[model samples]
Target: MRIRVDDLSGEATRSLIAHHLADMRATSPEESCHALDVDALREPAVTFWSAWDGDDLAGIAALKDLGAARGELKSMRVADAHRGRGVGRALLHHVMGAARARGLSTLWLETGTPPAFLAARRLYADEGFTECGPFGDYVNDPFSVFMMRLL
Candidate 1:
């Protein structure tokens, strides 16, 4: 699969991002859902990417610049057809590399705490992210798990 910076305009990318937002809302409370919509992802602070295998979109991920050499991982989603195929891991690494390229030294993320998010949490842990208190504009949230890694 190949990963590239996304403009958030393609139909497939838009559809996948909508589906990701819907899933986040369904699994987590509205107040705790931090997933950004397509418009939000287009903001200057966020850099979005889509992974593709030929004509198929394999996954999506984004890095939100938090300034001070920090970034927040956002909108990570592997297509249903690509689940368990290392798509997520690839996207994660792609975003991490992008962050490092931008001179970011730390990466942060907020994911769900429910069982639906277990695999995601495990993936982050396997990649060396550790649990941490909320950073940025986030406050302590029971439904959210915050993680961080120094690059």
Candidate 2:
């Protein structure tokens, strides 16, 4: 699979991100959902990527520069057609490498704690991420699960 930086403006990319946003909304309550919309991912501080297998989009992920040697993982989603194929893992490593190259000291993320997010939580844990309190603009919340990993 090829994972590359994406501008989040292509038709296919827009469609995929829309699907991602829809899934987040469907999976969690409005107050708990933190998945970014396409417009948000296009902001200057965020660098988005899309993983593809030839002509098929396998997954999407992004990293936000939180400054102070810290980063935030955002918009991580594996497409329905590619969930069990390790696309998420590969994409995750790609983002991690980018963060390290940027000299970030740590990477943080916020994900839901419901059954729908079991796979994501497991992935983060397997990648050496540990539970933590909310960061950035986030506040304390029961439905939110925060994780962090040192780069």
Candidate 3:
């Protein structure tokens, strides 16, 4: 598998991001879901990447600079066909490495609290992420689970 910075104009990357947003909306209804679409991923503070296995887009991940030596993980998703294949883990590791390279001392993320998100929670936990209070523009929302990791 190969993971690299995404241009957001590629069809495979766009489809992956669209699917991720749809899943977020389907899983969390109490809060307004606001995931970056392909166009939105092009923001200056955001860095997006796509993980590919040969020609297939296996997964994608993004990180947004939140200032003050902090960063937020956004739009992490593995293709349905790539689930359980370690694509998510690889993408996560890549993103964390990038964050560290950017001098971010802390990496944070918010995910849904649903059965569909259990694997994601477990992955974060295994990667040394601990539950944390809401950060950045986020507030305490019942539907969201916040996590943070020190780099």
Candidate 4:
């Protein structure tokens, strides 16, 4: 799979991002959702990437600079067809590599605390992330679980 910086306006990437946003909204209410939409992903402080196999979009991930050698992982998702195919791992490794390259010392994320998100939580834990308190604009919410990895 090829992982490359994404143009928010790219058709395939945009569609994948839209699907990710919709999925997040469906599983977690808007108030507790932390996934960014295309416009927010385009922010200067955030670096977004899309994974592809040939011309097919496989998945996407983004890292948001949080200062003090910290970063936030956002909008990580693998296409439904690509689920269980390691696309998510590849995207995650890519993001972590980018974060390290950018001199980040920690990477963090907020995911749903619902049964539907159990797999995601497990994935994060397997990748060396540990449960943590809320950071940034986030506040404790029953619907959210925070995780972090010290790089």
Who wins the TM-score comparison? 1
lDDT of 3 at 36: 78
For candidate 1, write residues 1-151 as lDDT tens digits.
8999999989999999989999999998999999999989999999999999999999999999999999999999998999999999999999999999999999999999999999999999999999999999999998999999999
For model 2, residues 24-133, the per-residue Cα lDDT tens digits are 88978898889899889989999999999999989999999998999999999998999989999998899999999999999999999889889999999999999999
Tell me the whole-model lDDT of each prediction, alpha carbons only. 0.96, 0.92, 0.90, 0.92
lDDT of 3 by residue, 17-133 (tens): 878888888878836575778777899999999999999999999999999999999999999999999999999999999999999999999988879889999999999999999
lDDT value for candidate 2? Answer: 0.92
User: Where does candidate 3 have its weakest 10-residue lDDT segment?
Assistant: 30-39
Question: Which scores higher on TM-score, 3 or 4?
Answer: 4
Which residue ranges in model 2 land beyond 4 Å of their true spot? Answer: none
Residues 1-151 of candidate 4: C-alpha lDDT, one tens digit per residue: 9999988778888998888888888988889888898889999999999999989999999999999999999999989989999998899999999999999999999999989889889999999999999999999999999999999
Could you tell me which residue pairs clash in candidate 4?
none
- Pairs that clash in candidate 3: none
Model with the higher TM-score, candidate 1 or 4: 1
Question: The CA-based lDDT of model 4 is what?
Answer: 0.92
TM-score of candidate 4 to 2 decimals = 0.97
**Consecutive 10-residue window with the lowest summed lDDT within model 2:** 7-16
